[model samples]
Target chain A: MSQTMPDWSVLAATCPSRTSLARIANKWTAMAVSVLGGGRTRFGDLKARLDGISGKVLTETLRDLERDGLVTRHVFAEVPPRVEYELTELGFTLHEPLLALCRWAEEHIAEVLVNRESYDAR
Target chain B: MSQTMPDWSVLAATCPSRTSLARIANKWTAMAVSVLGGGRTRFGDLKARLDGISGKVLTETLRDLERDGLVTRHVFAEVPPRVEYELTELGFTLHEPLLALCRWAEEHIAEVLVNRESYDAR
Candidate 1:
């Protein structure tokens, strides 16, 4: 695909931006980005922090983030090899918005729960 | 469940906030809220603006948003009975972040596509 358009819009159904939005809008992606914002973390450590994430799911999320140029994985040469994952410069730009979203969820859960109960009652 | 802790963390495995995040972090929910930010829109109109959304998915997304108290549904007493959807006060608060995420996707898509191509080649 050659680049002709100077702008992309998510509202456009066929726009590739929708695919990007789909990836980043995922709950696991949000949490992973939020956690990785702290600093570089090993795969196991990342999974542990995310809580309830299956190893496979966490690996896929990280791989997707890596493929998107958002996260980088590093391997250290040693008798016992170690791996670490960190946000790239581009990923850092994403960190703020995603973290803001996580904060929003946490801050508003009380009201959302109340609403769910009432809505379910009706 | 009784309320005790003041803080709700999505990082916690079983926190209700995760459920809330899971709901709002959905791509369809994000798109729906972004479009609804314009003002009240009929169901068909909302589906149209969202682009590529099926009627069933759009209906379910709106219902979820309504149940979460982030959206309000109004039914007009008319010959045919018209219905429209609008963001509630709480939903308005969600608008900024979700829209930001969508904008990020649009703005960063070129870079992401490039990254995907390069990653896939490896």
Candidate 2:
């Protein structure tokens, strides 16, 4: 029933998920989302969990995720204005696939690196 | 044993495949690679199989795939100078995942679209 769209091939052909995939699959996004997946997490804690992400990028990615409906942002009325982020249902559905991709990447890192070297020499 | 790199989390967090994923997961790259996967295909033939891809983008993607060692390019010595492209072993490894992603996209497209609408309205 839902297979009638024009962009269907985009996912089937290239993995339509590629577009938003970058958001969660990105270096910061993945870590940040993963951290949030455990439960709602504060921005500062997320920053700490994901080492080396700049405040600017973190804020930007979070905003993007929120905009895309993948993540929900909650702001508490308190001193310093406490804020938290958590995955929406749609975002949660991506867990298994994202985890699988990660595991695959981790398992195949050596091979991918080796391949990269071989490819570079060519 | 291979989970020692700093970038390990990138795949685990976001999906390391995101980088090369874009190459194969792009509109042109996906269709082109899929067509090439069947066997070695001429550039014009691939262009035909994948509708709407410009000659410029197709050439560029093929070049990128070749540079990344995902696809091999063959040039035949002939009056017309025949050329062909096909996936390398590494590129072939992506078949299952890529197919799965595409299928998922096709299957869940309506939901994604619905979600998109809802998101946009918010």
Candidate 3:
């Protein structure tokens, strides 16, 4: 059987789990982590892939993800200096569950939209 | 193999999947669904379980969840009138993945918090 959250798990006001979920729940963070799925990616490239994210949002998202331990940022001291991002092991675990959520969203998007329209019309 | 989202999956502006994800990603909705996991739950019970959500927020969240096809509302025609909410099959599927996320958050909250504190000090 799959896991069931304990009664007080996320209900607690100070639960970090709630904060943790919030981190990935933002689509920008979710997509950023998605892009890094293949392997580590450069900062410029990660930003490029998101396409719709503002530079500030992307910067903040990456910093937050790194701070949350879901992503790691590497900086090299070469002339041009290199900065790339990768998922930590903890991040990979999160990515799997998160990807499942994204897939569910895509597959059921039509039903959800139809339901929304009718519900709103009432 | 686990499902991987398509390249353009969540990157598009018109993606309903992103909207759907956004709906449940809100902690209020997430916790509400978690409470209803046992079976059908009444509005008062669900609201009480969440503890911190405003009456307005609970109303809005339930309406949104119902609209998105993740939850069903049943109104019993009686003197006082009765209403209960239960997960749809689709919602149940979502609950599984989401519970995993909640569990992940609780289990690793400490690590993430430590990472955050250290990251901020730098």
- Off-target runs (Cα >4 Å) in candidate 1 are A1-4, B1-4
Residue pairs in candidate 3 whose N, alpha carbon or C atoms collide under 3 angstroms: none
Candidate 2 local lDDT, B1-122, one digit each (tens) = 56555555442335555454334434455456656768888989888776666799888888877766778889999988999888889778655654554455455555665666787787
C-alpha-based local distance difference test score of model 3: 0.78
Q: Number of the top candidate by DockQ?
A: 1
The pairs that clash in candidate 2 are A11-A16, A11-B102, A12-B102, A25-B14, A30-B13, B11-B16
Give TM-scores for every candidate, taking all chains together and pairing residue i with residue i: 0.94, 0.67, 0.86
iRMSD of all candidate structures: 0.8, 5.2, 2.1
Task: Report clashes for each candidate as comma-separated counts.
Answer: 0, 6, 0
**Can you tell me which runs of candidate 2 are displaced by over 4 Å?**
A1-7, A11-37, A48-52, B1-7, B11-39, B48-57
Instruction: Give a tens-digit lDDT track for model 1, residues A1-122.
Output: 89686668888899999999999999999999999999999888988899999988988999999999999999899668888999999999989999988999999999999999999999
Measured with C-alpha atoms, the lDDT of residue B67 in candidate 3 is: 87
Angstrom error of the Cα, residue A18, model 1: value is: 0.4
Write candidate 1's Cα lDDT for B8-118 as tens digits.
Answer: 899999999999999988899889999889899998788888889899998899999999999999999997889999999999998989999899999999999999999
Please, what's the RMSD in Å of model 2?
A: 5.0
Task: Give the per-residue lDDT digits (tens) of candidate 3, residues B19-104.
Answer: 88678666676677777788999888887777667889888888889988889999999878888999998788777766666677
